[model samples]
Target: MNFVSTRGNVSKIGFIDTVLMGLANDGGLLIPEKVPQIPAERLQAMSELSYQELAYEIFSYYVDGEIPDNELKELIEKSYATFRHPEVTPVQKVKDNLYLLELFHGPTFAFKDIALQFLGNLYSYVSKKTGETIHILGATSGDTGASAIEGVRGKEGIRICILHPHGKVSKVQELQMTTIHDPNVLNLAIKGTFDDGQRIIKELFADVEFKNKYHLRAINSINFVRILAQTVYYFYAYFQVAKETNTKTVNFSVPTGNFGDIFAGYLAKKMGLPVGKLIVATNENNILEDFIKDGVYKPGEFKSTYSPSMDIQVASNFERYLYYLLGENSEAVTDLMNQFKSEGKIVVNEEQLLQVKKDFAAHGVLGEECLQTIKKYYSETTYLLDPHTACGVAAYEECNEANDFCITLATAHPAKFNESIERCDINQTYPIEISQLFDKPQYLEVVEADNDEIVRKLEKLFSFSTR
Candidate 1:
């Protein structure tokens, strides 16, 4: 299948090219030329299939003929074997109508591992097939860095460098990225917010010459493969619920920051999965909520909240959604995004606004509400949740009163955000290694929010390594 850029300027490309070129050259996200549909029979049979078998079934369509079926199946099996849970992503009923899709049962204790692990395996399979090396760069607010590091570390013919805001992530999150002293891994604590780090990575990708010279790839959700891997769980969750409870329409409430997680649900719906509602949950950085409600996109200052992963003002994946909403009118998306960049706002027509609200609902909770959700759930149901999951739980309560089954994504393990959990009066502590991560020496570089500064640092790093 071919992929097209959201901005409409870049030429349509194949899946492997789209995977390698994280961000489109026109400063837009890449989406499939067409959303492939899954037959009803396959969806019905998905409940009996293993996680790897299901993943191979879903992803093979997107991979086209690039990777053979046997190799792809092996990659899927090996990637998910790293997950701590045999089911890969299990569902737990938190309320009568609400269930928590526990997604942190992976090596890195975050939802990102569900996809990054598989993407790492796919990278290995592709590299072996093509006889090439890959350098992966990613920007993370918290979990993505650690998860990507865990997935890509020690893999031959692969090098990964992650950029995260220095003080934004929790100690355990920071330590998870830094403690892995793998020769193939490099961690940089960017002296800015996650947005700054993300911007730098985008700028680096825009430099086609630099990108090719270093064989740069991205581990971020911008990679279609990352989203493809994530899509498997949505189908898996739906079928699991269908088999256990015999339910048809399952609603998903995702605690979202960058929009990638919920977008996966949209892709599932596009593929004819029996998904009911795609609830978009947010923290204090609720730009997504505002945009979905009003159809006007405006990014504000990043808020430091209990759910640091959701502390994003501008979501990178929103552009891809805009492409679909605009009926794949790349020129229109380009114009709107440019207007947003310059004027800090862009308004959609009433029809477009109606279209968005019809399929999606959004709500944001304060930090206090997140903590209270954790405390209330723990006291009332004896179920523990991290701050991010708390946001999703609270949002779910606000939007949906009763449904056959509503699944809120548990984004991170409670151990990663011990401070937030304890502040809610829970008497829990993280691992000893987590407690000691604050004392480890960190290596990073401070830079201004300029494309030139990012380019210079990347060039210096590349030159020094080669010499």
Candidate 2:
């Protein structure tokens, strides 16, 4: 199936082009012309497949013969082999009706690894086939930068630059990106919030000439492929949990920041997966939660909570969801987005707001409540949640019905956020993977919020610009 630009200013493009183009030239996100629907029987049959197997099934509909089935299968296989768990994303029964989808089994110990691994391999595959060089540009609150770096590091014909908010992310998270000594990876600590880095990245992509000249691509959820790869775990987790609980529908509690993760769940629900409700769990930065609960979409002051990743003023992926919520009226979507940009807010009508409530439920968890959730689960059970996942658990506790089978997406390993763990005063030890990070020499350029320095850096460091 061809992908179409959400803004309606660009023609329908193939999956390969969509993957490479990333942010559409029209300054809109790419979405499928039509989200493929799976028959109940077929979807049930897919339930028995492994994580990689299920991914191939879901992805084939979007890959749509542009890549051969065998080649696609190989790509899926190679990508997931990096995961340490037998079930790449394992479903653990934390209690009777509550389950945790462990997504930190891959490299970087965060949920982003699941998609970045595939995207990195896909980039290499495409580059070798077409003899094209690429430079992947993205902004990260915490985990995404390291995951994306691990994905494309040292690969021929591919270079990646990641900009993160300086001193805003956790110590471990900062070291994860800054300590990576790969020649092709450039890590910048922008002197601002994650939103600042994100805005600069988007500004760079909006420059069509510069985007082409540098062969810039996105490794963020703004890339349709990342969202596509993420959907598989929801399906896999559903199948495993449903079979164990003998339940047909299972709700997912996702710790959301950029709206990309929950949007994947929305895509799954739209594709006819028996997804009950996508719980949009937020930290103190509750722009998404507020908008979902009410129709008011406005950015508030950025809060540097324990969950720094969720501290975003403007979610880059929210526009894609806006496109669908407006029923694919590209003109209206464009108009509303422009208004949100110019006015810093967008309010929906009562009718539209009701339709939104039907799609997902939202709740915001405070910083102290999040830590308490972490402490409660760790003390009561064996599972230790990271700060972000604690937000999901907190929201689930506050918003879940007694009978609903809920799966909280464990977005990161607890080791990544020692700040929260320490605050909770819990007895826990980090893995060697985490403790060893302290010994490595850190490296990153601290830059102002402007794009000029970034542009100059990319130009100067086009060839192994490690500095």
lDDT of 1 by residue, 1-467 (tens): 88888887666698888887888877788888889988888777777888778888888889897777787787888888987789899888776878889999888889999999888877776676777787888999999999998887877778777888888898788888888776677777777899988888887888888889988888888887778888888888888777778887888889999999999899889999998888899999999999889887888778899999988987888887888899989889989988987898879999999999988999999988999999999999989999999999998898874755888999888999987987988887665646676777765555565667666665554443311
Instruction: Give me the displacement of residue 97 in model 1, in angstroms.
Output: 1.3
lDDT of 2 by residue, 185-258 (tens): 88989999999898888889999999998788889888999999998988999999888888989999999899
lDDT of each: 0.84, 0.90
Q: Give the TM-score of candidate 1.
A: 0.95
> Which residue window of length 10 is worst by lDDT in model 1?
458-467
Cα-based RMSD of the predictions, in order? 2.0, 1.5
Instruction: State which candidate has the highest lDDT.
Output: 2
Model 1 Cα shift for residue 231 (angstroms) = 0.9
| Candidate 1 wrong stretches, greater than 4 Å | 429-450, 463-467
